[model samples]
Target: MAEFIEHNLQGVDSAILAVPVALAEGIVWEDLARMVKDEKMAGNPIAGLIDKLHFEKNCMIEVVLALSAHANSQRWYELKKSQERKQGKTFTPHKKAFKLAEKKIHLQLSQV
Candidate 1:
């Protein structure tokens, strides 16, 4: 999953899932626009909802600033080195770079 994000969803179903989800369930843009025009949506529900989604999705912060290959090659190795030094444990091939990016993004969004 992490690699997919870093590399972009080339053939993943997520790319398709994001569309309707973001437009309908995620943002509810049409209803939101109606509410805003009619003054029914108080305090900007659309903006609030978008902020919430971005927070949940973690589009704000990123852990590794590189492509999938770079992340796998250099960043992962560096992370392993740090882990070895800090915790004296062997580096496990578990963490995914895209997942790390998502985590960082979520953390920053939550702070906001």
Candidate 2:
């Protein structure tokens, strides 16, 4: 049997999912909007939910900045991991550093 994973984002608006998922899926706003429209036409009920969603300008900006920081941290982590692998060293430190950097970035984002 396959394991079932569920996310419980109680009290969190579903609109927030758009930013992270879009970034992960490499979809821009225009493309995502078009895809949503196509899905709605195809009778996907979830797609219709986007139509009712609205985010404040500041919230959108923050999401975009947070996503950018996440991407940067991911790249830094990958580079450090690769360099450590080449030197036959453990990557534990690199992983810790990445976590710390990510935490700092998030803190800065929260302050804005």
Candidate 3:
């Protein structure tokens, strides 16, 4: 995870900053998924960012941490479990199905 993040710094930072704004604007993970798949993300913030980073789960988890959502990785695991329980699904998140599980945390050490 650290290695991946180290390799993809620029894209990751974009994801971190862009995602929060998106969520504030009412964009959902599902919407991000559709945008990514359809490649119709023109005018969408994360569009054209694809080539900058490749989506990976560890990086996504790190993004969650950076957002101060969970305090620590253990809490993150708990959140993951709770989310799985609520959704009745497994690693849709870990597989990058969800994109931050769709902010596309594709977010860095030099991260903002």
TM-score winner: 3
Residue 74 error for model 2, in Å? Answer: 33
Q: What clash pairs does model 1 have? A: 2-98, 58-105
TM-score quality measure for candidate 1: 0.22
Model 1, residue 98: displacement in angstroms? 39
Q: For residues 1-112, could you state the per-residue lDDT of candidate 1 as single tens digits?
A: 2453345433223323333455656566455345434442455322222211223332212322123333434554576677778664333333465578889999999999
Task: Give residue 96's lDDT in candidate 3 (0 to 100).
Answer: 64
Error of 3 at 102 (Å): 53
Evaluate residue 75 in candidate 3 and report its C-alpha lDDT on the 0 to 100 scale: 55
Q: What is the alpha-carbon lDDT of model 1 when measured against the actual structure?
A: 0.42
Point out the higher-scoring one by TM-score: 2 or 3. Answer: 3
TM-scores of the candidates are 0.22, 0.33, 0.38
Model 2 lDDT tens row, 1-105: 001001212212343555457757887666766776887799864564344322334233222223333443454566667887876555677888999999999
- Cα lDDT tens digits for candidate 3, 1-112: 3344445556556666665566579877667546555563455434444433223442243455154322333455666778779676555556666655345344433355
Residue pair clashes in candidate 2: none
Q: What is the lDDT of residue 88 in candidate 3?
A: 61
Q: Give the Cα error of residue 106 in candidate 1, in Å.
A: 52
